[model samples]
Each structure stands twice: as structure tokens, then as C-alpha cells.
Target: IQLRAMIRWGLETVHRSLAPWCSVDSIARHLVEQTESLLLQLSDVRPLAPNKSALNHLLATAGWLTPPLVDGLQALGWLIDERGLAGTAATDGLAWCLPMHELFERWVEHLVRLWAYPFGGHVRSGRTFETLVPIRWSSAAPKSLKSLVPDVVVELGSQTWVFDAKYKNHFEELDDQAWFELAEEIQSEHRHDMHQALAYAATCPASQIITVLVYPMRLPVWERLTARGRSVTVAEVLGGDRSVQVALAGVPIQLSHPEQTNQIVAAWNPLFSVGQ
Candidate 1:
């Protein structure tokens, strides 16, 4: 009932506000028309305002039965997060948007963990609250600062590396446009990413600290960059008394062959640890 209502609400909102704009876009028109048709097939399913309590009850009741059910419940939960089409204006006045970074973050963690398995040190993830380092706040500070959490931390002996997965087009942008020629917003955002990565590095108390910003890119691009020794760009970030290397790396997605994956891991051996 709630699912049907959510769908109905979405269709209604789009039809009322977006119909004029969607008419000229072939793909958008098809999706809108398709949703209308599917809603017709689900006529027996009554429309109801999405209820959080009921949805939780349903998920807990059947989520344990099957994997598909769990996925469906998760998708439904994302749809009903406080970011509903029914915000402050009306019951049907917004669009559903989902961020893709969390999935990318998880994939980064998996890849790094898998490749660095031979190093023999524990892996910690920011998602699991395993890499949190509390911050000491001074009195009279309008304190929003709390702690520094790195996306992935690998500690091999006295050497530590913090890898922060950024789902950015920096690889592509840098390829197409010169650094200074890029848009102001892009440069600003990149600076922020760098700042966050530096903060993450502070969480480690190792003699040698390497902080890396890992971005996903096409396998072909990764290969091209590797040929030029630009796949992993590393430079000394801090001088004198402190040793810190800041690196921006391009990591390709998981490939088909085990040997191919191993090849990639071998290339990353220097950054993480010696190969097994």
C-alpha cells in the first residue's frame, strides 16, 4: 500500500509539474509514461501516505526470509527517508535523489582490504566507526568539531596510510582541462577534498604517514596513466621534522581475471606494503 502510494505521488507530482519539460525529452517521457502504465497494473494496490512504523514492521517481519526482500526494503527505505516528495510544501512536490558515494566508499574499502590482505595488519573503516579519533575542543569554541574519521586505514608496522575514496571526475577533468583552466567550483571542491584527506592523516601516529585520495576511473584510463607513471602521483606534503606523502591515485574497478586483479595489486604494492 505504501509503495503504491509513493509511486502514485511521484507520478502525480511529475505529471503536474514536469510534464511540459519532460515532453521534449525522449527518455524522460518514456520513464514517466512507463510509470503511469505500471501504476495502472497496480490499481488493486491502494495508495496510502508512506508510514515509517508500518514499513519497519514489514521489513522486520519478512527481511530475514530472502536477500531480494532485504534489497527491496532498503530501496524502499531510501525512498522514504525524510527527503520525501512530501517535504514542507505539499504531499507531492519533490524528486527522489540518491547519493552514490556510499556505495563507492564501500567498494573502495573492499578493494583496498582485499589487495592489502597480505600486509598482516588490521584494516579499519570509517563506516564501521573503527577509525575515529576524538578531538579535544577548547572552551568558548562554538564547537562543531568532534573527531577525525578516515575512510580506510591500513597500519603495517610503524608505517600507516589513510586512503580516502572520492567519487570524483578529477581523473577525467584533469585529462581534458589544465589544472588552472578548470572551473572555479571544481578547484574549490578539490581543495576541500585535499583538506579533509590531510585531517584524516592526523589520526595516525606513525613515523611515516601517507594519505591518499583514491578516485575511480576506467580501466583503459588507469592503464594509460600507469604507462606514463602517472597512475599514482605522490609528493612530500609535510617538510622537515614530519614525514608525510600525499598521493592522488586512480583505481580501476574490479576486473574479470584474478591475474588481472593481482597485477593491479602489484602496481599498488609500494603505496600500501610489499607484495606477498
Candidate 2:
């Protein structure tokens, strides 16, 4: 009954405390209206704690729909002076702010899974791909080799598509002339990203491997290049189905709106056609 509890909380909190024009009250009102009489049935239910830490943990672990409700509650808590309800007086005790980078990565993983599922591709996240190499000098000691865990890996037949979701906005990074001046120094991490994506392709256990460095960008773009005799490509995708070559590529994923998620899966369908 967490769902009912959430609806009840949002409904009651808005009614009790938030004015019509409060930052969150409008959203809360719309949510209550959408849920209709359902909240009335849960009159006896109590809402979750409005504490920032507790809500952040819940948002991280709860189902997709729950996070927004929890977020609304957080906003309500702050606007209506429920800081006392959080039971914390320290300034640092405020609600946690989830990192944008991690959220973007998760969103990309979701899109990858959605696109891969219908193509008979098994999509996995945080899959470790590793290889073994002998130590430089032999001794009575343990040996270790580094491993690669791409954000999303799609396995179809003997072909594997390795993907790393980078949260950095290449458009923003490259557009500013300041970044170009220190391009090598400021964008060293980008070079590392390219290296890592290619490394995954080279080391993966597949007859044919396609590596992609996926990032979020606001505009349409695509590029193909060869670095040290290896193929590297980049493309942007949004609300339309477009073909992306199934080789080394940097594909920009677009989620301009929540409703566009289905478009994302469709946009990348052409990737499966490649190497066929």
C-alpha cells in the first residue's frame, strides 16, 4: 500500500500546508486530481517520513513511479517547513542530491535494454569482461589483471555490443572555446573514455564486437573516424528511427522528454541491421 500511502501524503500535504502558488503545490494538486477518489479510500494510512535521507534512499530503491512522488514530498517538506519532522538540526542533514552523471548512466542503460530486447539481444549492465595476462616478473606472489565493466552490454548470437554511458555533454564541452584551448588537457578524460570503449571491443569474447561511447547532447550530430587503425564513430539520436553503423561509434542518446523514451528504443533499431 506504499502507492496509496504516497498518493494520500501528496494529497493531504498540499491541502494542509501548500498555497496554490507554492513551488510544488500545483504539481501536488494535479497529482491528487489525477488519482481522483483513490486517496479518499486511504484516509487511515500514514505518509512516509519527509526526511531527506530516508526519501533519497527510497527513491534510489523504489520503483519508477515512486521516485517522482517522493520528490514531490521532498519539495513539500521544504516549502511547508517540515524540517522539524526530519529530526535533524544540522545544515548538512538536508535531503541528498542525486548525482546527474549516475542518473544519466542509468537512463542510458534503460534505453539500451529496451532497444536490445526485441532483437534477441540479452542486455546486461555492469557486466565484467576481463582477460588474463602473466605478470612481468615471476615471483611467489599473486597476479592480477584489470577488468572492464561497460554500462550496458548487448549479446546477440556471436556478436556483442559493448557500451559505456558517459554523462558528459560533448556539445557543451566542445562548444566553449576555452575547452578547445586546453582540449588535450581539459578533455583528457574524453580520450580515456574513447580508449576504454575500444578496449572493451578488442577484449570482449565475441566473434564480432561493436563498441559505443554513448553520451547525452542537445543537438543532432554524427561522426566517424579511425584512431590508430581502429574504427571510431559518433552519432546523435532522438525521436526518430535512424541508422547507426554497428562498428565503433559514439552515439548521443536523447531524452528531451519522458514521453520520448519509446522513441529512443526505436531510434537505435537500425544498429541491429548493421553487421547482419
Candidate 3:
């Protein structure tokens, strides 16, 4: 398997060719070019045209880890419509697409870990196999759910924060609405998120648990919510000894200012304090 060469070439190709498809026009041109200089030294490895056939071949032969690397290429806009690989009508050849939920999870994990370090605790993530809990299925079927992995986990003394990042607009559409005001579909999905958070809390052993259901919010909207003291909604659940706190919060995804993200994360201190 030429997996090593393939991944290096793919990264360089993305930095060189498809970078424009996803580059933000608002960023300074010089800075963007400077970022390109940070690419891995791939002088000997020739560029690979990330076609579906080639990526598929690698996936079929390159053991288990090839999928994520191939996926990174797709995220970089190299897998455009029928031109590169077969895709649904969403691409439209001109538009760039990515699994925003996955991206949001990584962003949240990074931000949370930065703040978590001050607590003198270990930070873990599903991305690194740090928080993956194996499921014991009595009679496993073909392609059953493998593990219950919390997006981000932080351990602090007897308390733990299990964050589940969801990149949904449900807060804008469903938050503050009456139960009857929400559509059946939105209601169902919101409940599903809450249920999943509960499952994570149950699986993870902690005397005091904070199960955070985080969603993506625009910078302006997050600011508005913060002003009203509603950015982080804290609901104390499981009253007695095993105290569980269910937090419904939104994180600013497209951050405009540096302190804006810091402010959003700082609001979480109150929830962290609850466990202490």
C-alpha cells in the first residue's frame, strides 16, 4: 500500500489546486499564501489526482486508517461533483462541502481543551480513541453500532464534562418555542440529542456529571444570547448523590473576534463550578 505517499501528495494537492475552492475571500492574501508554506515537505512524492476510483482502491487495500485521510481530501473540495467523484446534487461544481458537524466537533474539542487545561485535568476526545466505549452486543448484526463515543471528555476530580457537539440550527428554530410550536421532526431530533447525552452520562462513571449538548451558533446570535444570560442553559438533573447537570449551549462557529470565543467558553465556568 502506497498509503504514506498517497496522503502526502493529497495534502499538497489540496494546498495547491483545490485550496481556492474553500479559501475565504476575507482572509489576507499574504497570510493565505504563508499558510501554504507550512505544508509537509512532499518534494519527491508526485501529486495524486484524487479521483473516486483511486480513493476507493486505497480504501479497499490500505487497511483501516485510509478512510479518514481520504475523507480529509473530500473535505478539501477535491471530490467535486461528478468531475472528481460521484456526489449528490449539492456540490453544484462551484460550491465546497464538508461534514460541518464533524468539523464543529473538532473545533469545540480544541476550544474546550484549552480551557480544560487550567483545571489540571486530562482531556480526551472520540477522535483520538480516548473516549470510545465498546458496546457489548449479544447477537451482533451486520454493521451494528460499534461504540458510544463522546465528542469531548474532561475529567476534573469527581466531576466530568462529557460534551456532545451537534452542528444543528435547532436552537434558532426550536429554542424558546413551546412544545406544540416545534415541528414534529425538530422535536424528535432535540429529544434524540438529550437522550444520547443521558446515555453518555450513564456509561461514564462520575459522582458529578455535566453532559453538555453543544450546538453551532453564529457570532452575532451567540452574542445576543450571551447578553440575555442564556448562552449556557444549565438544568440540574439527578438531584441526590449522583448529581447530573444537562447543559444546552451554543458555541460561536465562525468566530469574528478572538475574545468572542474566549467569552463563550468562559460562560461555561459556571457549569464547571457546579461540579466543584
Please give the range of 10 consecutive residues that has the lowest summed lDDT in model 3.
20-29
Candidate 3 C-alpha lDDT tens digits along 163-276: 999988877665567778999999899999999999899887888898999898778888888888888888888556688889988888776644455677687777777756
Task: Give candidate 2's TM-score.
Answer: 0.52
* Model number with the top lDDT: 3
Lowest summed-lDDT stretch of 10 residues in model 2?
222-231
TM-score of each: 0.60, 0.52, 0.64
Ranking by TM-score: 3, 1, 2
Kindly report the root-mean-square deviation of model 3 from the true structure over all alpha carbons: 10.7
Q: What does the lDDT come to for candidate 3?
A: 0.71
lDDT of 1 at 77: 51
Residue 85 lDDT, candidate 1, scale 0-100: 34
Candidate 1, which segments miss by more than 4 Å at Cα? 1-99, 254-259, 273-276
Give the CA lDDT, 0 to 100, for residue 255 in model 3: 63
Report the C-alpha lDDT of model 2 over 182-276, residue by residue, as the tens digit.
Answer: 55755788777766766566556676566777666552442111112112333432232322223333334443334455544555654665567
Better of 1 and 2 by lDDT: 1
Best by TM-score: 3
Off by over 4 Å in 2: 1-94, 127-145, 171-182, 219-256
The backbone clash count of each candidate, in order, is 0, 1, 0
